[model samples]
Target: MTGSELKKLLEDSPEECHKLLMKEYGRYVYAIVYNKLRCCGSREDVEECFSDIFAEIFIDFEYREAYKGDIKNYIGTVSKHKAIDFCRRLNTVKGRSVYTEEEDIRQLASDFNVDERVDSSELRRILLDKIDELGEPDSTILIQKFYYDMSSNEIAKNVSMTASSVRSRCSRAMEKLRVKLAAAGITR
Candidate 1:
C-alpha cells in the first residue's frame, strides 16, 4: 500500500494495524531484525523484536509525523533501531555489554560540535527549550512519552484521553515544537 493508505490502515485498532503491517512487511522486517540481532540477540530475541515492531509501527502511525518516504525504508529503519535496542537491553540484563543504541542515538541527537555539518546540538537545545516553554500538563505528557518512555495508552490513562487522542496530541505538540525550533534557526 501507499504510505498514505498504510497510514490510514494504521489508524485502526492496534491489533488490526499489527496484522496489516505483518501481512505486508513481515519478511522485510524479519530480515532487518535478524541482521541487527546477529551480533547481539539470540533467535528468540530477534523474534521478539520482530513482534515489537508492529506495536511500534502502530504508535508511529498514531502519534508521530506521517511517513513521507518509502514505507519499507521507514519500517526497516525503525526495525533496525529497535533490534539494536533490544539486543543492547538484553546484554545489559545479562551484564555483557553496557553500550546501546539508545545511548548512541542520544549522542547522535546531542549538540556535539564535532562537525560543522551536523551540529544537531543547537536543534536539540532549542527543541528542549521549546518543550520547556510548552509548560505543565502538555510538557509532562510529552516528556513522559518521549523522555520517560511511556506508551500512548499509559500516557492516555494519565492524561485521561483515548490512546488515539494521545497520539494525535503528541503529533500536534511535536509539530508545534518543530516549528518553534525552526523559527529559532534549527534547520534540517
Candidate 2:
C-alpha cells in the first residue's frame, strides 16, 4: 500500500488501520528491529520485538500521526531510538557497563588513535560476514541499520510500526551484537 493509503487507514477505524499495517508494512518493521537487536537475542526475541513495534504503533496512533514529514523516515527514526533505549535498559538490568563516561571515550581515542594507519577494509568485511550469520529478518535488519544507517522510524513506516518500538528493538539488537563481538575477541 502507498503512504497515502496508509495515512488514510490511520484516519479510518483503529482496527482497520492496524490490520492494514500488519498486512502491508510488517517486513520493514521487522528488518529495522532485527538490525538493532539481532546480535543480542534469539529468534524468539526478534519476533517479540517485531510484535511490540506494531503494538506500539497501534496504541500511539494519534501521537504518531501528528508528526509531519515522510512517514517512512519518521518510522525509521523512531524505531532506531526505541532499539537504542532497549539496549540501555537491558544493560542496566544485566549490570553491564554499556556506555562509559567521557573518560572512557578519551581513553579509547588515545589507545586506538595510534593505529589510525591501519586498514579498515578487512574489519568491515569480517563484520559483514558475522552479520550474515544471523537469521533471515535479523540479518536484513542489521545490515540496514548498522551498514546503511537507516532510521527506525523510516523502517517502521516502511513496515508499519510505532517509532518507539523500532528504537527499543534496535537497542536490544545492538546489545546482543556487542556480546557476540566481544566473544569473538573483537573488543575495544
Best by TM-score: 2
Backbone clash tally (model 1)? 1
**What do the candidate models score in CA lDDT, each in turn?**
0.75, 0.67
Q: Model 1 residue 29 lDDT?
A: 78
Encode model 2's per-residue lDDT on 89-187: one tens digit a residue.
Answer: 656777887658999999888887435445464666566666666554455566667655678777666546677776776676667777777877787
Inter-residue clash pairs, candidate 1: 111-121
Give the poorly placed runs of model 2, Cα more than 4 Å off: 1-4, 11-13, 63-69, 98-188
Model 2 lDDT, residue 65, Cα: 52
Candidate 1: tens digits of C-alpha lDDT, residues 1-188: 76676666666565666677786787567767776777777778878898898778877777876665568878878888888888889888888944468879788779655776555656655666788787655665787687646799999898788999888888888887788777887756
What's the CA error at residue 97 for candidate 1, in Å? Answer: 4.0
- Candidate 1 is scored at a TM of 0.45
